[model samples]
Target chain A: MMKSWDPRIEEMPKEDLQRMQYRLLKSLVYRLYSFSPFYHDRMREQNVHPDDIRELTDVKKLPFMFKRDLRDNYPDKIFTSTKDELVRYHVSSGTTGKPTVVGYTQNDLNTWTTSLARALTSVGLGRGDVIQVSYGYGLFTGGLGMHYGAERIGATVLPTSVGNTERQIELMQDLGATAIACTPSYLLHIGEVAEKMGVDIKKDTELRTGILGAEPWTDRMRTRIEDWLGIKAYDIYGTSELSGPMFTECVEQKGFHVWSDIALVEIIDPKTGESLESGQKGELTITILQKEALPMIRYRIGDITTMDDEVCACGRTHPRIQRIQGRVDDMLIIRGINVFPSQIEYALMAIPEVGQHFQIVVERKGALDDMLVRVELTKESFSDKINDIIQVRQKVEHRLRNSLNVNVTVELVEPGSLPRFEGKSKRVVDKRSL
Target chain B: MDTQKFVIRQISIFSENRPGRLAAIAHALGEENINILAFSIAEANGFGVVRALVDYPEKAHDKLFSLGYNVAFTDVIAVRMKDQPGGLYEVAKVLGDAGVNIEYSYAYSGKEGAVLILRVDQVDEAIKKIKNSGATLLERSVFH
Candidate 1:
């Protein structure tokens, strides 16, 4: 009756989840009609009143809001709280389009940071630990995000907003930074710079833990980062959309805890529009159970993943979800074949010769969609063997066909040829010229 | 569209994602005395073509392959011109006028002159006007 990921939330029992869910849901339902014009009109159109739901069984009566709705409403539109109380602003990546902005008030900031602190606690970062934040300090969530949590934990905070490679390493070493929060890629870059400066990152002083997120990374990447820095790397899963760093892997490293205190999590069929049972992968949706400035209900987060009530090996009583595979927006359909670019990234990263610099070009030829993958050599001063390029390309094609089961043309490029990114990198190009 | 034919000897080399692929190619070029005057790499889908203008490109091809790389040579035209801004636009316009679609292109120039490695829509005619215009279509060089 007890599963690995269930004990944390499972022992609470259905009655408890429902009790807390509806209590907040009742408040959220009221607020939807009270403050949010979209929800107010929506609930009216659905003709559903809060009292109509006798139990959590009627949670479905509440409407769902997708990312597109957020994009259309954007900033200042869907805000439930007035401008006076709004104190913090977080942004979603414009990867799919213009980034949507979300605002929070002082109380919301406290709740958000408290939630982040819970995530931080999962990995054992607390008071006195000097945490270096390398995520970009902008409208983006990474920087100020882990910052608030580090403060919440009373850890000495270093808001090292992303890269200035020389300065980052200098401060990292000089400050004896005990914990670092940044994208998994940037951390690797920092390690590279540290090695070149004759500072063995592995032998370096005091950095004991890393909170890496902002981009989806594989377990291989986890090992890669941890091995390079000689530190325990914990995965932090969140976005500006969800108030930042809601779920994080505990020291037990089983997976990420759902941080259910602030947000309610559910998995549902992206197509069927029905919530899926545990252990099934689907579109993730959440209700902002605790928020003042902007509370979203059944907000459809385009991230695709699974959830479970199974107890975690980590002692936490909250349930855990697997690391997100990738965003639904990142999906590519070439020749009517579904492909996730992360799959290609995985295949190419597995290849020693293929550098992280990769580009996918999708063009339509006649009635067929042709997708090409261009992987560059790691650096200049390096030449590719024609045989190796062909072999590697062939291997990549094989992997792509076998894994995503899509046909793709693979090209091997010279080093420094692919476009680079200072922030979240773009991976696919729809070169259909439409 | 039948133009003067100039062999560029494009070599397709396979390298992994790591530091030092260019160095290996440069080393081979230096050993063979193949002068890479004008070279460009068209990169996408992880593979790129290393097109170069050398003194004896045929010999460069042999040297690259012998160095344990799978190298292939394709004929291309290297058009020389006065080093200036519109020189490229002129070339492209001329090629475009002749209905030559550019499959790929890379350019390199120095104080003496500029050379454009162009894979044109119409290779033969474009080369004739280019050669007639006094542009020396340099051979793949051992002096690269």
Candidate 2:
């Protein structure tokens, strides 16, 4: 039977959801105006008041908060609640620059755990199941966020964290873990380790489902993982600001259902900031409706996706989002053609000869830009024959050009030569000064 | 194929075709007191494959791998040819006539004769063809 954590919230009518969002939006704006100075000044500068947002569309009138706001404000400027009221805090990698900080009050923590619990339950994980979390713990929300959710469902939680593939496999088999949560890439890495140890995960382990997210993965990769580990893979979605892994795919695996009660979402043309119609690919903007510590209005998440309001086969009324294509910052413009690293990943994964490790390097050649895709061959396919290797390289290049509509040089490297990451693989290297 | 004949192991080092790469690799092997008897660099695109017949194949391989160079061993039959002209022509004619394809070949003149290293499609068949043509097959101990 199809299961939902909160049937009332998930199956609410469209009109009621919109009306609830409008009411919540109004109160959230006033609360931000009263508590947070950054929001107050921004709202005053834009000449938008709490009364201005009588309806939901007025959310546009409020200033859109760029990720830069978090950087500029630094530690506590964005926090609506004081330090004494805070229960916990999480920080992003800040790899690009200063790390974005988020805080949660006791109530906010409850909401986060409950939201993730709903997500886990929606994917068919519950009481009798032992959910193993493979995401990195500590400062990263991926591990603890999923950890609390599984506990909330009365399931035995295995806080294995990440790394130690042999131990992870041992625990998965000996403990009979029925469900596991981690990035799809990491899951595949574990499968590879299992194979090397001669432990057939499909036959040896009791894992039946996987909750995969944190990095964008293709359906082709999903099929490979399913065939390798014999598990049903579900995509869960969230950002640190909105709470980790709140939206998730139900058993249908059609799209990720966003809880309207917790957040409001909008798709807009990233270049112009104008709202786009549903089903049109664009930038995804979100507003945290239930957040207490740091409430953001129209926060641009930078993810690119389309929304579908059609009711899912699982009967959830919450609008679903197509799997993220790529982050806006990850798009590459090569010789007047726009390409996404995920698109290249999808194309590369489609080819059976290509291994999962790949990198796209964009370089300026004189006046024109050139893209070089470095991909590794599988161990079985790595050949000593130069002509055979060259043929495989040319085939990869041809497939990439067919998908990206631009000429790309594909270099076939030896197996295990390219760098691999434990979390969030870096696949693109831009060397052009322009 | 003679069971008594020893097959010489050729160490092929994968490297980028840039200046000083070969010298650095040679320096590493020389530092280990391993002598490189015969060596050839095959260039393709921007990369090169440096194949060397070292006195101690196993020690050379370990040193190269420890230096983080992509290295592998390939078996190639080494036959003694005349040091004068028509030496390569004779070896090539015999292999071609026997329907054996020589993928690549390299040679070095020594005190005994010119040592021709041939990597063919069929190693055993090429060994028979070279033996039938009256060419002296060198043993792995010849390099050692």
Candidate 3:
């Protein structure tokens, strides 16, 4: 039978949930307008006021908050709450710009933990379940966020925050860990390390559920992990800005259930800032209604996905968002065609000869964009014959061309030479910018 | 008529076409005291397959594999042909007439004679046809 951490709020009627969301959204707007100078000025510039927000959909009038806003504010300049009320701080190390800081009050932490508690419970995890968190612990929110959520659901937290894979596998077996929360790439690395250590995770370990997120992964990858590791790998969604990893797909594995009372999610045309109807693909915009230290109203998350309001089979009335397609910032234009690294990963996963590690190098030659995919040859698929290796490369190139609608140069590297990550894996190296 | 005795194991290593790669592979093999009797490098699309008839095929494979090289063993037959003209045609004609397809062939001239290493689609058929054609086929002992 399906279990819920807070069924009163989780299984609430659709109309009641909407009513609650509207009230929370209205109160959050009024509070932000009264206290936050940043939001106050942004609302004035956008010609929006708290009184104008009569219905929830009127949130479209609020100016969209962006990563740059956080970067511009730097170290809590935009935080509405004072330093005394803030109990925790999580900073995302930006690759290019100044790191964005997110402060949370004690109440904010509870809301975040409660959100994950319901999420973890929806995925059928509860007491007697040992969750080994493999995400990076310090600064990064994945480890602590999952740690609190797993603990709140009455599950024993393993606290194995990334690296030491062989040791982690040993502890996983010794402690009899039942679930693990980590990035998908890190989990793949763990599986590889376990195989090298001669430990068969499927037969030897008690790990049955994987709450994998923090990097965009594909459905095909989910199938591969499930079939290979004998675990139901569920996609968890959130960023450091959203109080770490928040929601996850339940046992049904269709989409991630976004608890409506905590946050409001909208799909918007990223180019025009116009909201798209449900089921239409667009950028994911979210408004955190209950946050105190950092309340995000219409924060543009820069991820592309569609929304579904249909009730989940798991009996949750909250709306569900499909698996993240790709980040808008991660999208690359090759020869004037938009390409996502996740799309390349999805295409490569279908081929048997290609291993899990691959790097996409995009360079500008003369006038045209040249894309080269350096893929590792799996140990199982290595061939001694030159013709066989040639055929494999040709097959990979053909498959990529067919799927991406662009010609790609494929270079086969030795297995285990590609970089493996304990955190988010940087797969794309666009030399065009250089 | 015993063609099984003529089959020799050749170690093949996958290598990228980069500077010092061949040297690294040779150094690893030499550290294990393995001798490369006859070898051929096949190039395709920025990569090469270094196929060599080593004295200890299994040992060389294990050594290279331990050094993180992708190595495998293939069964190839060595046919002793005339060092002069038409020696390759003599063995080639026999295999072609017998419907044995030669996937690849590399020859080396030594004190013994010009021995043509043949990787055929039909290994047993090619061995039997070459043996029946009155040509001298080198046994595994000759290479080992």
The lDDT of each candidate is: 0.70, 0.82, 0.87
Ranking of all candidate structures by their lDDT, best first: 3, 2, 1
DockQ score for model 2:
0.08
Off by over 4 Å in 2: A331-427, A430-434, B1-144
Q: Give the higher-TM-score candidate: 1 or 2.
A: 2
Error of 3 at A337 (Å): 26
Worst 10 residues of 1 chain A by lDDT: A1-10
lDDT of 1 by residue, A220-273 (tens): 878877887899998888756677666788787767877565677888888877
Q: Which candidate is the best by TM-score?
A: 2
Q: Quality of candidate 1's docking, in CAPRI categories?
A: incorrect
Q: fnat, candidate 1?
A: 0.24
Candidate 2 CAPRI classification by DockQ: incorrect
Worst 10 residues of 3 chain B by lDDT: B65-74
Native contact recovery (fnat) for each candidate is 0.24, 0.00, 0.45
Q: What residue pairs clash in candidate 3, if any at all?
A: none
- Count the clashes in each prediction: 70, 0, 0
Top DockQ hit:
3
Higher-ranked by lDDT: 1 or 2: 2
lDDT of 2 by residue, A1-434 (tens): 23877788888888999999999988999988887888999999999888899898888888898877886778768788889999898876332324568898988878888888778888888888999999878767888899988899888999999879899999999999999998776787788888889999899989999998876767887898898799999998887778667878888898898888888889999999998888999999998899998887889988899999788888888888989887777756564334667677778778888787788888866434679998876535444456655677789999888777668998765456678888777788988652
RMSD of each: 14.5, 15.4, 16.7
Candidate ordering by TM-score (highest first): 2, 3, 1
Give the Å error, residue A21, model 3. Answer: 0.7
- Candidate 3, residue A254: the lDDT equals 91
